[model samples]
Target: KEYNVAILGATGAVGTRLMQKLAESNIPVKSLKLLASKRSAGKKLKYRDDVLTVEEATPDSFDGVDLVLASAGGAVSKKLLPEAVKRGAVAVDNTSAFRMDPDVPLVVPEVNPDALENHHGIIANPNCSTIQMVVALEPIRKQFGLKQIIVSTYQAASGAGQSGLDELRDEAQEHLDGKKMDAHIFPVKGEKEHYPLAFNLLPQIDVFEKDGYTHEEWKMIHETKKIMLNDMNSGAIKVTATCVRVPVEICHGESVYFTVDDAKDASREKIQSILNDAPGVTLKDDPKKQLYPQPIDAAGKEDTYVGRVRPDQENDNAYNMWVVADNLLKGAALNTVEIGEELVKRDLI
Candidate 1:
């Protein structure tokens, strides 16, 4: 089956990657529509030897489109996602806008493609950090009932979009040349203060709420539960996160510690064996050879990589592992395409 597809925010980091993946995806495309802001309307992007022009997005953009892959931003998705649906397109949004909306399905194809069955014309892709974590954890959660998850994310600058990456690059060159460092991005662009994000750790990804946890941290906490169990207070699992923006250019890494509700049956070796065969996951643990997943190795890869498996000495039920994946691929773009493909596979579209 073929369909007309439109990509909102087609010129941004995730948006650009989404366009690239569409060319390689199995979903047949009758036509491709690229929508960006007014300033990016005339910009051209290449796909399968076709240099497609990006147009300004509006409610009418999705008029003839059967599918909408939105990566613009949270505010933009909140405003136009429903409009796209109203115009007869099922929007798979890569934002936090409708993730917790109750009506919209927060989905990760490999982890919860079933959530897409009852889509209200809009499906939200989980946060980049949350997406990779759950992809690595879903197998474990299924084999052994999950109890709690505590993850510390090493997020990439790309999570903030291309502007965040630009700032990191400029800061790095200036700092190395011993020039005065300029700070305008990272942490939060609109915040009262900005901090350097090169050769340094900010320990914060977004603005801090009254509770001291940043928005990025909260997304990981809430979105994980919603995608994994479809409920925040489902008591199915408890999740916590400390999101930090590192100087890395691409991909995100997480040091995750999880407690199994039934560890007796799912030991460390048992969990590792499950992950080895888990879908969308690539196990890379080999402690003797000092082998494990790394951001540099995971960047540009489509699969979520898991390694550094170990049992926590403090608790027999608790174990730790490292997870990594290209933030743009599995975390955002490729996952959106995967959802669209899944929908197509089931003739849901």
Candidate 2:
């Protein structure tokens, strides 16, 4: 069966990778449409040997599209994803826009492909940090039963989009040249303060809410539960996050501390063995050889790398792990494409 696919935000970082992943995917594609804003419209992008022109996205763009892979932004997704669905396209959105909406199913193909069956035309891709963390823990959760999760994320500059990557590069050169560094997009672009992310780490990703957690952190906490828990209202699994923007250009590194329900059966070796066999996960834990996943090694990869698995000294039921993945790939683009493939496999689209 062939499907017509449209990519919203086609010219952006995640959108660009979505196109690449789709080309590499097995989903039968009868047609491909690239949709972006007016500024990127008329521009051309290469798909294998075929050059596709970018069209300005509108309600009419989804007229015959069977599937839509979207990552434009929250506002863009909010504005157009419904239009796509109205026109009969099932959208896999890589944005925070429809994520928390009860009607929309937030899914990670590895953790919860079954969630795709409940989709009402829109499937939200979880936050990049949350995506990798859940993928690393899901196998453990399935085996030992998850109880809690506390994650500290070392997010990349690319999380802010292409402008953030450009800013990081320019700032690095400026700092080395002894010139005053200029900041415009890090630590939240809309915030009054913009700090250089070249040699510094910002504790904030999105705006802070009344509870003092940044919106990104809040998303991690709630989105984790939404994806992992059987009930959204269940406080069964506690999840908290501290999201920080690091100087890395790509890939996100996370130190995840978690506790399992089955303390008697959950051992470091047992967890490692389970992860090794889990789908979409690559186990890299070996402390003797000093082997573990690294951001550089995980960059551009699809699998979530898990390493440094150890039982917590204070709590037998608790454990710690290091997880890494390409934020643009597994976290955003690849996951979105995988969702599309799952839909095809299930005949859901």
Please identify model 2 stretches exceeding 4 Å from their true place: none
Instruction: Give lDDT tens digits, candidate 2, residues 237-346.
Output: 98888999999999999999999996457788889999999998999988899999998899988899999999899986999999999999998999999989999999
RMSD of 2: 1.0
Per-candidate count of clashing residue pairs (backbone under 3 Å): 0, 0
Q: Write the per-residue lDDT of candidate 1 for residues 174-243, one digit (tens) a residue.
A: 9999997799987788989888999899998878879999988888888888888789556678888898
Off by over 4 Å in 1: none
Superposed Cα deviation of residue 161, candidate 1 (Å): 0.9
Task: Write down the lDDT of every candidate, Cα atoms only.
Answer: 0.90, 0.92
Clashing pairs in 1: none
What's model 2's lDDT at 335?
92
What CA RMSD would you report for each candidate? 1.1, 1.0
